[model samples]
Target: MESQPHNDRLWIKLLVLLAYKTATHKHARRLSWSSQTGGVIPISPKLCIKATPFTQLAEANAMRFVAQHTSIPVPMVHCAFEEKGQTYILMERIEGDTLAQVWGQRSDESKARILRQLKGIVEQLRRISAPPSIGVANVDGGPIFDHRLPRKSSWGPFATIQDFHRELRSGIDAGDIEDDASSPGVKDMASFHEQAWQAPVFTHGDLSALNILVRGDEVVGIIDWETAGWYPPYWEYTSAKHTNPRNLWWQEEVDKFIAPMHEALEMEAIRRRFFGDF
Candidate 1:
């Protein structure tokens, strides 16, 4: 497996040695003060005594995925500890610009380039064999990702847009929802799926570009898996391009950026349903 550079390892060994002799339990702190190796300055190792094993496992798995898989980039894990309520995880850091940095300056050519790259990343993610699955345990963290859905019946299919609008009014009347809850994207999807349409796909539940890293037009890495989970097929389709108001930061560019892709995903879902295999 591709591993940390030799220099980095040597550097870490020095840090470990330093930790062993510290006056206080200042392991990573003092090491970082004098650490000036490869322009890499790590955050002080967190006191993970309160972290659950589940968090450590998630960090471990994310590292493994980054190390083993070539599609999406993630951090590399060097060491980990899980005991009682305490968890310790060590991993290499990555640096890159975010996709949002370029969203605001969307030129015609830049727009096309970013869209193509985004599409390619999704296609690649679809090809990645699902990551290892972990069971529900009382422990808080682990190497495997558990992709349980957040909630069920959040939304469902509608026979027509009219039916969706009616429900929307009712929901809003009850003060349980916002007005845009009945958007064209959501309303149009009413007849397309059902409670049973949900599937088990490994997903980075929070897929916003803010969580993504970019080098030029390429998506180099995706970060922040705290909300990662198994999600339905079309779950991301709506917002992938819809540029929901929730992500107001990119709202302006999102309309043009995701318009075409959103259209394609919608039609694609329709085709799948018509094939009877859906």
Candidate 2:
């Protein structure tokens, strides 16, 4: 289940649009009105003059992190600047259609292709040298946000499916998630494999098709890693399944994605710079 931090994020988006433009029907001068890229047309290259402050910083940080470390595909940030009341983030536009919209319109016939592409992207991100972590708050003297616990633990004391499920269930109840959205509350944390899996190399917090760019069966570029976090590798499995063509509430999809990749991820000795369990 997702944290309802920005439970009405889309509504906030709408409100932002309304404030920027008197009418909601038309997008602003810097428009991504539609990011539908057929193989024939490319993704647009334009400055998002009014990109949110949070998003602009995240995009800039992600691009910098990618350039400094890994080569896995992600958009390149041209520059980030703020002027007056508007903040601008310029990025290299990927040349493929967004997987999210495409997947929704496709029948089950396209589902296999979507999953394969998704799997491939997840695999790519998993190969990164460092999982994203700031060690604390972004700015010096800012609020300290520690993901590490007092006891040394890989993936923060929860690596197996049962443990993951329990934590997720706790979140659902604590967050007061609706019944339809909560996980089935695991009966035993020992039922699933007890082996510890590696903490996240870099889990894209938001793995929706909207953040992905696909060309046929390949994921050319994953545009947004704003919500990317450091945690157990299996966390992405839950996230990807939710954004799939058919959103299977924790029951079917999350476990399926992890079962296939668990063996490969667990045996490695993790080396992360300024990375703490999340």
Candidate 3:
């Protein structure tokens, strides 16, 4: 027999399918779409559906986990399920502009207030304890996803930070570096990766301004939890700094909110230099 939760999910899925069919000819509006990952559609004023073939149910699971554990405002997940080779997340549609949209128009005071609220939210996220034996993993203690990583696929729920670092180095051991032959930069990166790090903490993984929703000076919501997971404390800071040219201004503001991890950022730069973002 199917589990109770599975049964409930099936019922929800059926209802969602019906609603989707009905809304298609009337209320549905595509919020965002991608050829690779599917899209988000609003079927009602207060509800939306995010359907994607590339995303796992883990994204919805991460949102629910944050809602349950912290005071951070995130979209309320109505249901998440898989059917016809795609994952669908039915969620509340929050009414607010992404921080990216209003950032340039805001005064310094307004920006500071928003950043303050975000700092508190980040603190709350870090305070959540990871399950025992959890290394680097998603909310469900499974492989974590990141588009920045090569192949844009799920990586390991590594057993240890050292193991995770090894993976980051593309399976190259620190000792594999020849002191006499390897470039100074390569040797530095290998040494940096060998250093011990503090225990993993809950991380939002991607802290882009595009993901932060704001209303006036308040941070009303933080959307896009697809990359959330238990990760090294520096992961948040470094990830925030890894933004593109369009987000350069946001990257400058990152250190003001999250604690700066300069060494980690430098190490990450070295890794990227050796192995360009593919």
Identify the candidate with maximal lDDT: 3
Q: Which candidate leads the pack in TM-score?
A: 3
Q: Give all candidates' CA lDDT scores.
A: 0.43, 0.43, 0.79
Q: Give stretches of model 2 more than 4 Å off.
A: 1-26, 29-50, 82-87, 104-117, 131-197, 243-278
Worst 10 residues of 2 by lDDT: 267-276
User: For residues 248-275, could you state the per-residue lDDT of candidate 3 as single tens digits?
Assistant: 8888999889988888898888778675
lDDT of 3 at 202: 91
Q: lDDT of candidate 1 vs native?
A: 0.43
- Across 96-206, the per-residue lDDT of candidate 2 in tens digits comes to 787655755666656566666556556666776542332212111122112222123212223333354334333322234322323232222222323444443556655
Count of clashing residue pairs in every prediction: 15, 3, 0
Q: What lDDT score goes with residue 78 in model 1?
A: 64
The collision pairs in model 3 are: none
What order do candidates take by lDDT, descending?
A: 3, 2, 1
True-vs-predicted CA distance for residue 266, candidate 1, Å: 12
RMSD of each: 11.6, 12.0, 3.2
Looking at model 1, which ten-residue stretch has the lowest summed lDDT? 134-143
